[model samples]
Target: MARPLLRLLAASCALGAMAGSAAAQVADHGAPWLENPFPSTYVPLPRSDVMLRHATILDGAGNRIDDGDVLVRSGKIAAVGRALANPGGAREIDARGRWITPGVIDVHSHDGTYVLPLTTIDREAGDVSEGSDVNVADTWIETAVNPQDTAFSRALRNGVTTIQILPGSSPIFSGRAVTVKPIRATSVAAMKFPGAPYGFKMACGENPKENGAETHRGPTSRQGVVTYVRKAFMDAQQILRDQKGEDGKPGPRRGPPAGRGPDLKREALAGIMAGDLRLNMHCYRADDMATMLSVAKEFGFHITAFHHATEAYKMPAALREAGTCAAVWGDWWGYKMEALDAVRANAPMLDRAGVCVTMHSDSPGSGQRLTIEAAKAAGAGRRMGIVVPPERMIRWVTSNSAKVLGLEDRIGTLAPGYNADLVVWSGDPFSVYTKADLVFIDGAIAADRSAPPASPASDFELGRVAAVRP
Candidate 1:
């Protein structure tokens, strides 16, 4: 981690400014870069109070309303119905043929973390894993976040307003993941999602083993990985029992870990045990996910979601019972042994069996068409005489993913109290020719197909790289 970030974390922890009252009790040696500016570069347009009348609306909660009206006031969905009594001063648009849905929430992305110029001839510039020890939970992707990444522009045009930038999963534990609004900002802190809890990344398959083998570490097998995880948490538990409170004395056992951790790794592990940090575990096989669930249960820490779980369909019942969501692709299989047994219906099958299912793009290009990915996954179920409606398929990229990221309360659904993060599609979102005609982030226009929308372009791309589409 960078020295500036460490200084900020130290200052925030010392002043009790990280977040909430619990920050005073939580361990102070991890990623706590919570001092953020307003949503970076996202200018609120004059039409902050606008109403879209007579459109097909997908609430992102499995409800579809034809000829619906959504009124946005003060960056919130004020009303949603067939005929809303519009405010006299609000701007109104007759969206007759368009469809409105909540802005896409990408659960697993490496955009800022693996920023522009991914490859520099010799090595990838933003490889964010400490492979030497395979347990750098103290490290954070935020310090590596390059807000100048041009990928943010493409995603915004595709209706993605929010995304979780996670660390690479090459090691057993990479580090803490940061959530951000996909705005091309001057710095990552300016784009950080307010009030969103921090997440940690953990991988449990071929990548970790390979990294360990290359580094001459001990965790060369799955058993070894499991053993290492157990010991790390147990050690963290002991440390949590040995920290001091903000008043320079041991406080009552309430929320968060007991006190400050001696190191970054211990602080993060303690955060997980305190039950506020979300774990975005990268596992491909069903057996590995099953074992992970058992481990999470033993440690009393929840596994929020399993990323790239290609074989999630094989263990839908277990996943559903464990209350963990699966973030997967349309048909990314056969590339590796663990991911080889996957079928295209993996997502659909998981959906049918009552497991929380979502489609995610670990690749930057694939992320541009995540709606198409969900359409394909739903199409696979259609061939099998099972129907995955567009309304439900939308959740595979919107609500379901948001729930996994712990931002469901604020942004996912197009409800009355949720953030007015929505996209207006020219046609059915699942249709190949459809494009995001107008996108709203917090009720402000972020993109438009008809006009040159606000520039999501980074300062780095302003003069050097011209805008291709807009």
Candidate 2:
């Protein structure tokens, strides 16, 4: 992290008090702090050099190769081609009948944060949405992440290796998003993706406004929601301006008036302005999305993606022009008024208009079956004569989604020098009958069907094992 960014975070920590105990834990940042408070403790599992040969490969960049080979060495892809010379002593896997592709990346998920075993038990119901206020920018979703969430194991079994866990859409500014690798770990930090940038989660449309209305607070209408967002950004802009010196040099003479505590909300919102945090907005209607684009222009910050953008097809050109990705569900629609205009060909239309299109799973079940969800969208495209092939459609769950998280260079594709995060399927990945035979994370076998213990189970699942057996 840069010194300026660190100072910004320290200033944010100076807020008088936070909503919950989680923020209070990391509230005090003494001088000379050089590390993140919630730093990653993830270590790659033991792995060995391996060569998978004669498999059909979709490299996650709109290319397919048959009878191909993938060489994994030191937890990174060493080579990818046909008939490549294998440096001896590498374990060889005969994958002649299998299909290999980049591991599935779910851009929008609430797996760990929402958690399982929905009950009245403390913390078991999960800390999803903090409805106390409209802007909870100071909060982070990872603080409530339960590493023991059984959903991680289920997602691993279905070939998902990386997931960007976001806060729920029940607040205008929900919280910050955390990207994690779905691996067995003791702490949420152990699953955090190293070097991944943080994402700010914001929302528009029915969910936020309705939640506030039900709580008997303000912002019951769409205009009120927009007003809240605009006012927050305006405050953030003031913070940035106040941080600069009159002489245009670094000094305590300008930023925050020397001794006063920093505004945590504006500090976090400033991160988006400083280009340090990616902005992900949950929006559904076309008009609402366009309104967000205009706000982005006014504030000089980019909207990285529009999650659950059901009506993005209606304004594909605007999304493409803004270079914002439309992360949508495959076929989910009609559940609410804003989502009623969704079409099955939403993704295909965006693709046709040269927009970056990706698919997302906002639920646990959909997270496990992400590939088939992409297939559903692609199938809908085919019916509309859009003709998205398997090679390109695979990107909806892989590379394009990676782009949404701003980690496309490392984990999304099967290119040389990329992380060896991939999956081998029993058959065509899009086929409903096919399943992930093996899944690898950073060259380590995370799941294997031919071997015992297909995937590591959470403690919750382990306790239930006896009940499932005779």
Candidate 3:
């Protein structure tokens, strides 16, 4: 049933319960259901004006603006320069001697959907999978996304302003990925980053193979995995061609008519073929990565980035030649057969080869502390005798990831025209001990450690004390 009709049925049932005492008991039980129910509408809250002065700014464009003053007016960056005066009416923040950069963006994340705070029983309906099929390209992560989850707060406190949440790699073609703003809001639409393009979550190697094997599918081996992907693309190509008409004679339209057919798989492949969606493949083996690149070339689609690319260092030249970005972990190794060859210097080696490398934390626990992940990458590079400048290292999480997300024009850098998404660290960002003093999302202060929120339960100690006294 449609959501509105279901809600109407529920309301009618509640109204009908006042006929008798037993009916009144039913009404009492339904009261909690009426409080903050699903499919709730959201109105975005008003943002505050903010200004920061006297900060060491890493602009995410590999340039440093020493002692810069950044002015944010009406939720956008108004000015960024040296020795600038703040507008008199704006709220001012003193960030002297602190490192300020654009808020970090994680290209690969699974925080909101595969959440831990909610009970696991909520996912028992098997909605996480589609029709018992592994390749569910049409399913969107946004549909499963929960905006008001505590993970959103955790991610924002860790300085992540935006994230591209993807489906798990348990399938060959997992689903569509959605980019979201890390903010507490009433609905997912309120938290969505406007105009951000959707990405397709594609996988190779172990994930698809293992899933297919368990289901008695042919793709139990690496070669079988490649064949499965190739067959799907080939069918999609045929479908596209048939829709275009054979010899201009008007053949039967493939899948469904424009905006009419409900075939999710074909619609997803069509989006890819038309270049409306990006493909983010999860692969760790070097040969599998190469195969994915070749397949993308054959299909005339762009490979936006490779996630968990542990063996990316082995094929740095190939990756750079293909103009693909690598979203990899800092130093995770020996956890899987494909990742056995992973090394600590993987990120730096790819960086030195002129390949775009971004540090990604695929785990929810790790996503809450990505600054330390970036620091680990930098430290590993230094230990490997490869000297990457601190500014360049900052780009791996900020500008470079934004570039991979196709959002470089907006939120990656601290330029005048970019979105005022920034973070102020308590100390040097490269040091592991440093913490985020303040975090801003679209020029509005989202978190501040020193000054807590107006709510008494905003801090741990106050919350415990309040409980004890009661």
Candidate 4:
């Protein structure tokens, strides 16, 4: 169920206070901070009083408005045109010769779940698995989310305003995923999009096998993987049926509601079955991808996106027909047998076939710099004679990702009524040397390379730089 807007605002306020308190405590200890040195002081100001003028606006809708002025007020884009009525007391920013676009969104990421500055062993500490079963349908990535991680700042620096933090695909049905803002807040609620549906993390091939060897349970083989997912959905259907009365009255409310469950796995699966949760499946091969689509059809649920779909170009028509999204890498290939057919032209081919394709960087190192990934896709498409436009290519990492995460209306474009989440680039964003000059999330400045924020000390980063200096 979606949280009330008031509740979300209150939660954000509480979490902000908690984050401030945590930072103060860490500083009191007089120790170096192990987390990112950036501060997370996001105080939302009145957006009605800000405007960016004389900029080339690349609206993520595949349109470019040159020498335009964008007026934002109350955190929503109010006007975008050549001439603007500047109300009194509005701050006008000179953006001449610069490019403005929606802040980049990474549809596939693992930053929050497997957070750095903490031991990797903590990922396994919580029983993310249920009953020792691989397909834990009730586990939520948000529940285990640690909001104080340093990767949020790094993501902000790279112009990534939002990301879907997914669990590692160690199981066929890994767990639920969360869509989060790459900002500093003390709790998951503050960072979470208020009503965004949770996502089920399903996987195929290598990651599902136990101990790198086939076991007796389902999904030991490729066929087994398909069967396992089908069976689970069938069970969920049965549960759904039993929970509803023949007279159209609710029956005993099933096991439990979302976000509160004795059986964590089933709780997560229930959300999917009820169409309240999206499915973000990870598959590499074309055949497996087809089978997964078939399973979705049999269960009457839609797949939001397929991550790391290296061979998606082969079945672009099918993917397009089903309205499924392909979140893929630009040129990563041959790391395994399933990924052998990965080609540089994959994204272009899919795009030409009218598939909603988005490029993603699954690596921690690569996640912070996905503009380069989009550039690579554009370069590959151009090399293959695809002639994809620059505006269209930018959509692969911005608007298309927002579509996959079901947040297209809010942050993926610089249009009227959209949230003021945008990035100012130092040069043409497609160029290799281009960088983010400023990043705004919900009309608040989150990152400005020209004037960086004061570094906040945590227990682990105190005086270490000075001590190591020559």
Pick the TM-score winner.
Answer: 2
lDDT of 2 at 340: 91
Which parts of model 3 have CA positions greater than 4 angstroms off?
1-44, 117-131, 242-261, 453-470
In candidate 3, position 333 carries an lDDT of 88
Model 3 Cα lDDT, one tens digit per residue, 1-470: 12232243334434444554333423433221121112223333467777888898887888878788888887788888888876678888789979888898888887667665445533742133332466788677778776645667778887888888888887888878878887776567778787676688888998778878887644788887788887887776543444334453223324354675455686577556545567899999899999989888777667889999999989988898888999998878898799899888788888888999998878777787776787787788899799887778889899999988889899888887788888998777777777888888877777877876534332222323445553
Q: Best candidate, lDDT-wise?
A: 2
Q: Rank the candidates by lDDT, best first.
A: 2, 1, 3, 4
| Candidate 1 local lDDT, 1-470, one digit each (tens) | 12232233345454554454543434343332232322333444445699999999998999999999999999999999899997787899999999999999888898865666656621466655656578988787778877778788789889898888888888798888888887657787778887687888999988888777877875899888999999998877654444334653333333334474346677678667655578999999988999989888777777999999998988888898889999999978898899889889888899999999988989787788889999888889889977988888899989998898888998879999898999999989988899998888888887777886455555656655667996
Candidate 2's TM-score: 0.90
* CA lDDT of each prediction against the hidden true structure: 0.80, 0.84, 0.74, 0.72
lDDT assessment of candidate 2: 0.84
Clashing residue pairs in candidate 1 (N, C-alpha, C atoms within 3 angstroms): none
Point out the higher-scoring one by TM-score: 1 or 3: 1
TM-score of 1: 0.87
Per-model TM values vs. the true structure: 0.87, 0.90, 0.83, 0.83
Which residues of candidate 4, in runs, are more than 4 Å off?
A: 1-48, 117-131, 210-218, 248-263, 457-470
Q: Residue 259 CA error for candidate 4 (Å)?
A: 22
